[model samples]
Target: MDLHYVVQGNGEPIVFLDSGGADLRDWEFIAPSLAKSYRCIAYDGRGAGQSPSPIEFGDYVEDLKNLLDFLDIDNTVLVGHSIGGRIATDFALTYPQRVSKLVLIGPGLTGYQFSPELVQRFEEIQSVAPNVEKMAQLSLELPSYQVVMTSPQRDRMVEMTKHNTLRGLEWQHLWKNLQVWGELPAIPPLNELRVKTLFIIGTQDSEDCFRIADLFKQVPDIRFAHIEGADHMPTLTHSLEVSSIIREFLGESKL
Candidate 1:
């Protein structure tokens, strides 16, 4: 499928990857700020937004590769969130020469072993099934998301969740398959990554995410930052701080 994408600004290329439940608009608040000096590209992943559905799990890695090839892009920075981060990591490892830098925000690890408690929580969430509205509402009600719900970007975040929920209902089975089938193989050792990497995590994100970040600490060329009071959606809840961190990492003067 030809994914829907938007590009802005000029200079070094930086691609923004959306979370599993979001589209390119997830970066609406943060992308423009970075786009002032860098070429920022955000795209809708398969089954989200205008993108098509029934995307095979294994096809995600290749979908991104194809997107870059079609755009004639190379040696660019990849900034990804949640499941998007998984895609970015896989891409960087598989095509190291094509990636200049990697920014993982609340990233998901490949072959992650979910805690039994987390698994139970997930099962409960799944039990709600096709009731996308309730699922979306429940997501926001989580303690991790409370901070974002009260922030200035709350409306946008809610809208994005609703949009994602609708898409989730539309492609329920495909979405479930993507979650299971897209499971990546064992991650390569951190030392093998020659490209610069940054991890920006929310202090209040799930424990599993924190554990994943701990594992990335072994990477030689990597930096870490913790956003207080933010959660998985830090890009939305803490846009200014997130953008500033990205700007600093890229060595760009503040706007």
Candidate 2:
């Protein structure tokens, strides 16, 4: 698909994938910091930014595979947020040999089924919103969505979020995939995973996030960090600490 990206530094490749509704700019705040120590590569997922929109989620995975192949990146620590996390897990499961490690930040896994109320609310906000101004206002004002934005990040987030095509996301398909794949539980499945993993979740995120993160308590060779006072999008809310945590984790757990 010839996706575009911003590559910085030169060392171990750490691919940072943003959550759905966000673009590569989502990583702009932290990529430079991470680049100081590792090769930081951040790109807009297919259908998000400069990348071409795909027919399906599997197409997104194929896009990632092709990007890596094109770059000759044989070993990488796939860092993903939300849906990006789901993709990373799926990639690791399907091609274990290529992944060096995994880091999920508020990863949207298929663990807990989305409540009907939550799904309806999300659909209303994403699809049925009467206008962009209303959607932007609602997103910034709502507690569930506010955690990811500060005064600075809020402007950029609004810009990127508005780029999302409400119809293309197919909320039903996303919900169905969450139910199916999350049910498999990536945390437990990691026992079969030969690589190391690190999961970061904000304390203020959804209960479902907390519940799924809890499932990883027993998995060996995995480290979990809770960023206090942060929400689903800590990369913007707590960039300094988030970047520090990731760098330290990578340094300590280098393979």
User: Against the true structure, whose lDDT is highest?
Assistant: 1
- In model 2, pairs of residues that clash are 82-108, 110-182, 111-182
Model 1 Cα lDDT, one tens digit per residue, 64-116:
88888888897799999999998898888889999999999998877777667
Model 1: lDDT of residue 244:
94
Please give the distance, in angstroms, between residue 241's alpha carbon in candidate 1 and its true position after superposition. 1.0
* Residue 220 lDDT in candidate 2: 69
Error of 1 at 255 (Å): 2.6
Give the runs in model 1 whose Cα sits over 4 Å from its true position.
175-185
**What are the lDDT figures for the candidates, one per model?**
0.84, 0.74
Candidate 2 global TM-score: 0.83
lDDT of 2: 0.74
Candidate 1 local lDDT, residue 239: 88
Which pairs clash (backbone N, Cα, C closer than 3 Å) in model 1? none
Top TM-score hit? 1
